[model samples]
Target: MKIPVIGRRDDTADTPDHPATDPIEELRAQLRRVCGGRLRTLDAEREHLDARRRGEAARMRRVGE
Candidate 1:
């Protein structure tokens, strides 16, 4: 028999005061947390690449001059 794993505390029947927690909501929260870090890292990478591109362009111009 496969046991169902409930990811959120609100999914429990005992928590009447809380709205029923959706498994997808728990997943979305985790996804957002994980992707947030990835986004920051990508942003930093983009900035670095842009700066490198600019530096390369400047160097080429200097060489041409």
Candidate 2:
């Protein structure tokens, strides 16, 4: 004997009080939050390295002259 195939009901599902979020979007938001500080630190380091390289290049040019 075959039983009735009841369709899924969203209302029946146990959802939290907040709205549901897409998994991918949730992960992207998490990455943005976690990596934001690291990205800022990396940017500061890059600027420092660039300034050091420029200073070295200027020193070399003066030495050559």
Candidate 3:
């Protein structure tokens, strides 16, 4: 997904030696890392939940018979 250029600063009009560099890239990189970590944690939780559900279903079937 392309990160939108919403917060980018326009530094083209500045003096030759004092041109502005965008700081938004650093923030974007940090956010990306945080999102990746969250996804990993959520995936692990989903796997754990699925396993529990399967174990419960098996127990229920045994009880019903």
List TM-scores for all candidates, in order: 0.40, 0.39, 0.39
Q: On a 0 to 1 TM-score scale, where does candidate 3 land against the true structure?
A: 0.39
Candidate 2 residue-wise lDDT, 35-59, digit = tens: 8834335788799899999999999
Which residue pairs show collisions in model 3?
none
Best by lDDT: 1
Model 3, 1-65: lDDT tens per residue? 43334466455425685354456654655566878834335788799899999999999999999
Ranked candidates, highest TM-score first = 1, 2, 3
Q: What's the lDDT for all of these models?
A: 0.65, 0.61, 0.64
Give a tens-digit lDDT track for model 1, residues 1-65: 22225563524435665455578765665566768834335789899899999999999999999
Better of 1 and 3 by TM-score: 1
Model 3 lDDT on a 0 to 1 scale = 0.64
In model 1, the runs with Cα more than 4 Å from the true position are: 1-40
